[model samples]
Target: MRIDAAIDAFVRQLTVDRGLSEQTARAYRGDLVDLAAFAEEAGVTEAEAIDLELLRDWQWHVSDRLAKSSLARRTAAVRGFTAWLARTGAAAGDAGARLRAPKSDKHLPRVLDRSQLDVLFARLEGRAAGDDPVAIRDLAIVELLYASAIRVSELVGLELGDVDRTRLMVRVLGKGGKERVVPFGVPAARALDRYLGAGRPALLRDGIDALLLDTLFLGARGAPLTARTVYQLVASLLADLPGSGPAGPHTFRHTAATHLLDGGADLRAVQELLGHASLATTQIYTHVSAERLKAAYATAHPRA
Candidate 1:
């Protein structure tokens, strides 16, 4: 099979069989497409014609251009693609088996302090109280994100029926298409109710069609909300905050988990709520908690 054809097959398997998120599959496809383009430039387009040298050369070609994290991801993508090609008999061997990726920098995710969150939510609720449709939706969006600690993907993927208001819980379709019921607080439930009853209807009045049908969150035009829109919303929300890290939806995820830990929620329970496949990933929040405690102690101790 041609390298491009093999790439498509691998991505299809990733999407259909592996059940990876479309965003993740798209990233892998993009990385593999870069590799295939490099292979064609090297006069070897067939999967069977791939070699370790071609893989190494491609990595080196982009090493100077992309960030270490991006380069590492590209390397992993090629490694997985070549291994799949070998397993499927499209390639004689795993050409990228020995490919090494640059080490990605590890940074603890930024979390919001309790005061910051209190002020933020207070402002949002005040605005939402005024009957602003977008403000209501924005408050609901942040409320659900922080309350459930679900990914923004899961947030935007929600349907009107997914929310179980009586239970104060929501059914989130997480990564790998896994479904889990995550509980939210009364505050979030109230914000959500206000949005659904008043905000959503107002947006629908502007326009409504099948494309806008059933989606829980609506864009400015009543279409299903996009991830990019959520990103921009969160970015603007955190624009003036003090701290460093991604000003994106995941910050709310981190903050929620950390706050839960601070409030004495069980570790495993948080793991289930976040839909993390590994406890090790959940343990990172413990580290964040410990760090916060140390900072508090250092500031308060008289001897220090």
Candidate 2:
């Protein structure tokens, strides 16, 4: 089979059979496409022509240009693709079974301190105190993001029925199509109430279709809210802060998780709240909490 056709089949299987998200499938497609181009350059365009040496050469070709993390992801992508090709009999063998890449560099996720969060919310609250619908919606978005620790994708994908205002819970469809209920605080509930009662209605245009009406959050023109919009909103808020890491919506998630741990929330409970499939994935927040404690002890200790 041709490499390109084989890659398409692999990506289709990733999304359809493995239930991977579109974003994940896209990443796999991108990596495999690059590999296909590389293989073509080597006069090895056929899927069966690919071997462990070709895979290693391709990794070496891109090693200098990509960071270890991106290289790791690309390596994993190709490994999966080759494994799929072998499993489905599209290739003679798995070319990437022996492929390896350097481990990704681990950095503690950026987390906002309590004072920083207070400053952020104060500004948001000031903006929301007015009658501006966009400002109101923005407040609600930030509040819910920090309160629920949900992914921005899950947040924008939320629908009207997904939220339970009476119980302060939200149902989110997480990665791999897993559904989980997360609880928010009273502040988030109040902000959501204000948005639902006034902001959303004001933003909704007349003659809108019923599908958009079911969306939990809407754009300025009554369309469903997008992940990019949420990213910009959170980025702008985090830009003025003293931190020096990523300023996207995931920062809110990290901050929320770290704060939960700092306040004595159980590790397993937080894992469930964050919709993490594995406790190991959620343990990073414990590291963040410990780092914070170490910073405090180092700064305030009398004998240091």
Candidate 3:
């Protein structure tokens, strides 16, 4: 079979048999597309034509241009594709199984401090008012992010029915398409209410059911907000705020988890609220809380 044909079959297997998400399948398709392009450039069109040397050349070529994370994701895609091809008798053996990705630096996720969060929200609050629908939506987006600490994808996935205003809870469909209800404070609830009642309605056209709709903010064309757009908004907003750290939705997630711990929220409870897969993932916030406590003690205590 041709390389392209094998990739098509592999993607089908991912979608039908493996039950991978569309996002995952799309990523696999992208990786294989890049690989196929490289193969075509090298004048090898068939699956059987690829060998270990060609694979090494592709890896070496990408190593210089791509980040370790990208390389790793692509490697996983190819490995899965090759394994499926081998199992289906399209290839003699899985040639990509032994492929290894480069070592990446373990950078801890960024978390905003309490004071910094206050500053960010205050800035957003200042810009919250206006006849412009996008501003109102942008403010609510930032507020909900800090207030809820949800993934960017989850934020964009929110629907009108998912929010329970009376209970101050937002229902989210998280990883693996699992639904979980998370509650936010009155401040977040109020921001959300304003966005829904005032902001979204202004931007909605004929057929929008999204909570934030064409907005809790809108693009220039008044379309639904995207995850990349959200990231850019957060980064640009944070560019003016004082202090240094990674700034994005995940920053708020880490901040919210740490703040929850600082406020004496039980670790397990925070885990549940954040929809963490394991307690271990949630335990990282405990260290941030402990560090804060140590700093407070060191600054205030006079005893030698």
Candidate 4:
């Protein structure tokens, strides 16, 4: 089969069979598309024509253009693609069986202190006490994100029925379509109640898009809230905050996780709350907690 068409089928299978998120599937597809282009240039127009050398060449081509993390992802993508091709009888062998990329450096996720969160929430609440529907929605967004520690995609994907207001929890379909329930605090519940009672209705219109109508979060035009819009809201909130890493919606996720750890929450419990597939993935917050403890010791202990 042609490389591009094979990639298309593989991506479809990733979404439908593997239960991968659309974002993850698209990323894999993009990496495979880049590989297909390089393979075509190397006269490997068909999946059967691809070889280990072509995979290596594609890695070399991207070495100067992409970061190590991106390179690693591309390598992993191609490896999976070739494995799928071979297993499905589309390729003679797994061309990327031996492909390797430099390990991506692991950096600690950025977290906000309680004081910083206090300031942010106060500001959001102050603005939400306005006549603007968007501002109120933004406040609710902040409350929900920090309270639940959900991904932006998951937050935007919330439907009206997904949240159990009386229970103070939300049911999220996380990566790989795994459904998990996450609890929020009373503050988040109050914000959501206010949004549903007044803000959402003000922004919504009669005969609004069905997605928007069912969605808990809506845009200014009453359309479904997008991940990009959530990112922008978070970026604007973090624009002036002191931070090193990205100030996107994930910052809140990191902060929520760290704060939970700081509050004596169990590691395993937090893993469930964050919907992490592996405990190892959730262990990063332990490092953040240790670092915080060391910093607190350094600040309070005057001994040299």
Superior by TM-score: candidate 1 or candidate 4: 4
Least well predicted 10-residue stretch by lDDT in candidate 4: 205-214
TM-score versus the correct structure, for each prediction: 0.96, 0.97, 0.85, 0.97
Question: What is each predicted model's overall lDDT from 0 to 1?
Answer: 0.92, 0.93, 0.80, 0.91
lDDT string for model 4 (106-199, tens) is 9999999988888899889999997789988999999999999999989999999999998898999998888999999999999999999999
Q: What are the runs in model 1 whose C-alpha is more than 4 Å off?
A: 205-207
- Candidates 3 and 4, the one with greater TM-score: 4
CA lDDT of 71 in candidate 2? 98
RMSD of 4: 1.1
lDDT of 2 by residue, 1-304 (tens): 8999988888898899889889888888998899999999999989988999999999999999999999999999999888888888888888899999999999999999989999999999999999999999999999999999999999999999999999999999999999999999999999999999999999999999987789999998888998899989988999899988789999999999999999999999999999898999999999999999999999999976
How well does candidate 3 score on lDDT at residue 220? 42
Positional deviation of residue 79's Cα in model 1 after best superposition, in angstroms? 1.1
The positional error of residue 138 in candidate 4, measured at the CA in angstroms, is: 0.5
Give the winner by lDDT: 1 or 2: 2
